[model samples]
Target: MIEIRNLKKSFGSNLVWEDVSFSIEQGETVAIIGRSGCGKSVLVKHLNALMYPDSGEVIIDGRNVFDLEYISLRKMRQRFGVLFQGSALFDSLNTFENIAFPLRYFTELNEEEISDKVMEALELVNLAGTSEKSPAELSGGMRRRVALARATILQPDFLIYDEPTSGLDPKTSEEINQLIISMAKNLNITSIVVTHDIHSVLKIATKVAFLEDQGLHWYGTVEELRDSDNEELMSFVSASEYQIRN
Candidate 1:
């Protein structure tokens, strides 16, 4: 489980957010939504300690992530898989090599073992035949799949997706959303998604967290979100022209 308590952060004198608190149960998929520059990305980065709060605690399992030693922190980070907003694949690396990067760095696996694991991850993302292809050779959706394949190659306990569907057409966005759902369900991985896509949120998230006014303005289940009377949340959803999927 992840518990964030009374979090506060700022850069210089510009405050990002304050009094942010929430808990994510293991195996749950929570979508963080807010206006652009509301610190959604910064907030998720706090989960794995890529960013630290000026005050408060982010506890993963039972340990405070910020307090861990370097070696301990490295081990803790290996348990997380992050799918960056841009897919962030190395253009020089082939799919197999990209997926093998984590296994090679974090595990004691030989080339044969890495190959086996990478192939399994590729198959999981349904891109089994594209191992030799570079990121430049794949379509946007295919590239995202390859990124996902690499993200899950280590079978992380938690997955963080930063704008997973940005810049994609609707069909491709849906495909990626389904892939996110499939990964979470199949691996029983806890998921934290920072996205602006409401459609993806409805399709993939069990819970919705709204960050606004320097804190978590709202946090609840998807059903509550759709039926909610909260003016701020309703306005945000309506502004996006998002209709809840029935």
Candidate 2:
């Protein structure tokens, strides 16, 4: 289980959020939603210790990640796999090499083992034949899938998706959503998704965390979110859906 305790952060004099707290049970897919610049990405970054809070504790399996030494922190971070917003694939590397990069760098796996692992990851993403293709040759959605393959190749305990559905058409977005669900269920991984796509949230999230007004404004199950009576949250949801429609 992951527990976030009264987290706080600031940039110079600009306070981003304060007193934010929540817990993510194992195998849960939690979606963090908020308007742009509301610090949703910032909050998820704290989970892997990519960003430190001004005050608070991010405890994973009873250990405070913030207090870990460098080696310990690196090991902790390896337990996480991140699908960056832009996919962040290296254009210089082909798909096979991109997916194999982590295994080569982090593990002692030989070339044959690396090839077998990369092939498995490609099959998982349903892109088994595109291993030789460069990122530049793949469409936006395919690029995202390749990125997802790379992210999950190590079978990390946690997966962080930063705007997974951004810049995709509706059909592609739905595919990505299903992939997210499949990853969580098949790997029993804890997932944290930062997105503004309310429809995508509804389709994939088991729980919702809403950030606003400099704090975690609300949090609950997907059912609770749909039935929520909070005026601000409802307004935000409605507005987001409207944007999707028009």
Candidate 3:
């Protein structure tokens, strides 16, 4: 389980958010949603210690990640996999090598073992035959799948997706959403997704966390979100739908 306690952050005199608290149970898919620049990405960055809060505790399995030493922190980070917003794949590497990079760097696995793992990951993302293809050869959605394959190759306990469907058309967005759901169920991985897409949130999230007004404005299950009468949340949802339709 991951527990976030009294999280606070600021840059110079600009306060991002404070008094944020929430717990993510194992196997839960939590969507962190808010308007652009509301600090959703910053909040998820705290989970893996990529970013730190001015004051707060991010406890994973009873250990405060903020207090860990360098070696310990590095080990903790290896348990996470991140699918960046831009599908940060290495253009120089083929699909196979891209996914195998982590295993080569982190583990003592031989070439055969690495190949097998990479193949499994590609198959998981339905990209089994494109191992020799470069990132540039893949379409936007396919590149995202390759990125996802690389992210999960190490079988991380937690998966963080930053705007997983940002530039995709509706069909591709739905495909990515379904892939997120599949990864969660198949790997039993805890997921934290930072996105502005409300429709994707409804399709993939088990729980929702809304960051607004410099705080975690509301949080609850997806069902609760749909039934919520909270004015700000309703407005945000309506606005998102309007944008989607236009």
Task: Estimate the TM-score of every prediction.
Answer: 0.96, 0.99, 0.98
Model 1 lDDT per residue over 89-187, tens place: 989999989999998889998889888888889888889899999899999999988999888988899999999988888888888898999999989
Model 2, runs deviating above 4 Å = none
* Cα error of candidate 3 at position 143, Å: 0.9
Better of 1 and 2 by lDDT: 2
Off by over 4 Å in 1: 242-246
Superposed by TM-score, candidate 2 places the C-alpha of residue 219 at a distance from the truth, in angstroms, of 0.4
| Deviation from native of the Cα of residue 154 in model 3, angstroms | 0.9
- Displacement of residue 182 (Cα, Å) in model 2 is 0.5
Which residue pairs clash in candidate 3?
A: none
Query: Which regions in candidate 3 have their CA more than 4 angstroms from the true location?
Result: none
Write model 2 residue lDDT over 1-246, tens digit each, in one string.
899999999999999999999999999999999999999889999999999999999999899999999999989998999998789999999999999999988899999999999999999999989999999999999999999999998899999999999999999999999999999999999999999999989989999999999999999999999999999999999999999999
Poorest 10 consecutive residues by lDDT, candidate 3:
146-155
Q: TM-score of the candidate numbered 2?
A: 0.99
Global lDDT of each candidate: 0.91, 0.95, 0.94
Alpha-carbon deviation at 185 in model 3, angstroms:
0.6
